[model samples]
Target: MNYEHVREVDPAVADALEGEVQRQNDTLAMIASENHVSEAVLEAQGSALTNKYAEGYPGERYYAGCEYADEVEELAIERAKELWGAEHVNVQPHSGTQANQGVYYAMLEPGDKILSLDLNHGGHLSHGHPANFTGQLYEVEQYEVDAETGYIDYDDLRDHAEAFEPDIIVSGYSAYPREVDFEAIQAAADAVDAYHLADIAHITGLVAAGVHANPVGTADFVTGSTHKTIRAGRGGIIMCDEAYADDIDPAVFPGGQGGPLMHNIAGKAVGFKEALEPQFEAYAEQTIENAKALGDQLQERGFSLVSGGTDNHLVLVDLRESHPDTTGKDAEEALEDVGVVLNANTVPGETRSPFNPSGIRAGTPALTTRGFDEGACREVADIIADVIDDYDDADVKAEAAERVQNLTDAHPLYE
Candidate 1:
């Protein structure tokens, strides 16, 4: 795990890298999009494959000596297929955003309509945020969760899809904490004759472990990031029925990117192999249990959860109702000072700037990776409430910092 070679060549970079490792070890990583990969995955991602330019798919290449690269890529594709149960899988997209781009390229013209969840309502930037390329290139409309219930209003989505008559309907989310009903969304897309793109970027590992319902067989296209719940180093994947294989392959390759990052694909392969073992299922189950426990503890302390609770890895806490005087950023900065890390996110019907939104999003994947269970997460919830309640008090922060240290010491990262 030590970067001795890097130290000899670039001590400055090595210092920063080692500093990051120490930071992760010391702090609580509750950020919903992150997870700590295994040391085997770390070694695979840092392997010599990084230097190879594997520009094409397995058994097909634009350069010489791609035999070994092909082998690695093939294993990643096969394992992904087994994990997600898609007839066709493309492991080449550089990210989940690029994976979405591949699907759009294959399915729509520049002006075609897209219907997706609203960004402030737990959707992703790549889905159709005005600042993102997808929003700029396509005519976009959005749906939202119920204002009172904090759950996706599937009926509204279905009605909106009919009115929009979009080229595609995007499901899945970034901040919403409930399990998705992919079948319901699929029915809506079918009625509108639109393609269904399920961006399960945050729940990839949950679906693989059978804790979350899979979108592969139901959605027309499924895209996800390998590093979130899955603990694969970092990359994106796309799955589809064999019917659209040709359209997708070209769209991802010459359509969006050039050479693939073989090392990242190798990390995905190793992580997927690790996930196939029996123990991974328990890990996935515990992640949800921890989230429920964390949210329950927060509720008992008077924090307002967006969905009342969660059925998945993360929970969205609306600071407006719980601590009206304190902004999400205020809590975020104070928590960081106490060595607790998470993100301030926009909640439904948000009134503040996205830079400093109304809610904080927390998750259990990273903590669970470090061996945290329900009891540890409940303790963390109390620490979070303490900071939010008295963010300016040094005594409170010091006490909370001590608690965070105790938790981190108990369930150490990268140990």
Candidate 2:
């Protein structure tokens, strides 16, 4: 992965690029939204298509010399349809937030009501955080997970929907660690004659592999990030039935963005093709198994996990109850010092601020990609427990760092 030409032109940027490669190879990536893409995906994303400007959908571009761009975009759309079984797919939203924006721009009017889960309860900013455009433009209301069980309060959601009469009811999550009941949310949306937008941004690969319940057929609009569990390059996708296809296409292109990132679309096509293979299903299943193992070990170490455990690729640990003195940021910094990478996250019924929350989130997609299994993940959990138990102890961090090096050595990446 030497950036020979890049070094000749821009040595500083090349150094940073190589440093990132080394960083990924040396550290554990437990960030829930991150994954290591295949070399094929990497190659496609770095291809010459990045220079092209394909302003419209396949075969209907606004510019000439778009034959190859059209081919890549069409392949991405077709492969996405096959992977997710959607009647229509838009692969040009740039990111999951943009994908959500497409749905809002297409169907929602200014000041329209939006009912979604609370961010501290596992919802995304695109759903309706005050800092995001969705919150500023729409009349937003939020629902919560059960504080006791750490699961979605579907009955409460339904009750809220009936009262709020939102234009759209959003399902799916970012930090929650359980299987979502899409049907229940759909019913809530139906009861109020509102649209359902299920943003499966975190579990796109699981849904594609049938490990998680798919919302494509249940929700009116389904959106996801291509990179999370899908092992695609960084991009967003929107899927829908034929009824809203026309609206979504323009909403993503002319309405939201100028020209599509055709290189990323090519990467998506390649990654989707890779995901269609039988091995990807096993990978998805193993990702869940690894997360369960990681969470169980954390629990046995006297840590508290949201929803008790995970049904997907990530686990959410609430440090407030388990380690009263420690914050998520404290644990996150200590873990990173030991080469274990994750993030500080907000748990349901959060008491602390979002920046320094009470919970830590971890996932196994990147670990599983590096060929880590349940036992390896459990060992990683033990290291995490040690760090969190004694974050200020240099000796403890040193020992954990040695173990992390051994783990990374055993599962080399980008070789």
Instruction: List the global CA lDDT of all models.
Output: 0.95, 0.95
* Superposition TM-score, candidate 1 onto the true structure: 0.99
Which ten contiguous residues of candidate 2 have the minimum total lDDT?
A: 53-62
Query: Global CA lDDT of candidate 2, please?
Result: 0.95
Model 2 per-residue lDDT tens digits across residues 1-415? 9799999999999999999999999999999999999999999999999899989888898999999999888899999999999999999989999999999999999999999999999999999999999999999999999989998888999999999999999998999899999999999999999999999999999999999999998999999999999999789999999889989998988999999999999999999999999999999999999999999999999999999999999999999988999999999998998999999999988899999999999999999999999999999999999999999999999999999999999999999
Off by over 4 Å in 1: none
What is the C-alpha lDDT profile of model 1 across 247-358, one tens digit per residue? 9999999999999999999999999999999999999999999999999999999999998999999999999988988888888899999999999999999999999999
- Point out where model 2 deviates above 4 Å: none
Best by lDDT: 2
Error of 1 at 318 (Å): 0.4
Residue 64 in model 1: shift from native, Å?
A: 0.8
